[model samples]
Target: MPHYYLHLYNDMIVADEEGLDFPDLAAARAGAIENIRGLICETVSKGCINFSHRIDIADASGEVLTSVSFGEAVRVDG
Candidate 1:
């Protein structure tokens, strides 16, 4: 299993010091999306959502594998 770091990029850069083990990149990406959704839920009470928020998935060597935008994770209809 390889370790993947999901770093949050919102108003500030929240680094994931303690990385997680995932079988592959796809799983890591999914994990990032899930985390973003949870974060969004928590932020709902704040009365403002920043769609530009994103999570950058980085490898052990500090290379960013992919990024998941908060806007991409949820569908907003008004």
Candidate 2:
């Protein structure tokens, strides 16, 4: 198992000081998506969503492995 940090990048940088442990990068990616969805749900009550916001998944050494944009996680209709 390895620790992966999912840092949020919205209006500002929110560092994940306590990282989560996952079996692999794939699992970490899934966790990131899950987290983003939960965050979006919480923000819905705020009446605004920053689609450009993103989560940067990093390894224990702080090297970003990949990123997932809020816009990419959900479907929006006109």
Candidate 3:
């Protein structure tokens, strides 16, 4: 199974969904990124910390797939 790494401030989140089949890789990747951003925003909000940090998510190969700045993420309007 393929694995993904979501890097956060003090912890790293990993998910193994390689064996799962998807219709589109782009959609799957984008969905994964969005999910991580939501998680980051939720964590920051609950901790009352500055949701102004950037999060970097990478693949198993250590390649950065996407970067989400805190400001852009915390915004209410999409």
RMSD of 2: 1.2
Tens digits of lDDT, candidate 3, 1-78: 455554554244344434233344454455555765677766766775445455555666767766655555545666
Sort the predicted structures by TM-score, highest score first: 1, 2, 3
Residues 1-78, candidate 1, lDDT per residue (tens digit)?
999999999989999999999999999999998999999999998988899999999999999999999999999989
Clash-forming residue pairs, model 3 = 2-18
Best by TM-score: 1
Candidate 3: minimum summed lDDT over ten consecutive residues — where?
13-22
For each of the candidates, the C-alpha root-mean-square deviation to the true structure, in angstroms, is: 0.8, 1.2, 5.0
Whole-model Cα lDDT of every candidate shown, in order: 0.96, 0.94, 0.53
Clash totals for all models, in order? Answer: 0, 0, 1
Cα lDDT tens digits, model 2, 1-78, are 899999999889999999999999999988988998999999999998999999999999999999999998899889
TM-score of 1: 0.95
- Any runs in candidate 3 off by more than 4 Å, and if so which? 10-47, 76-78
For each candidate, what TM-score against the reference?
0.95, 0.91, 0.43
- Model 1: residues >4 Å from true position, as ranges? none
> How well does candidate 1 score on lDDT at residue 14?
98
- Which candidate leads the pack in lDDT? 1
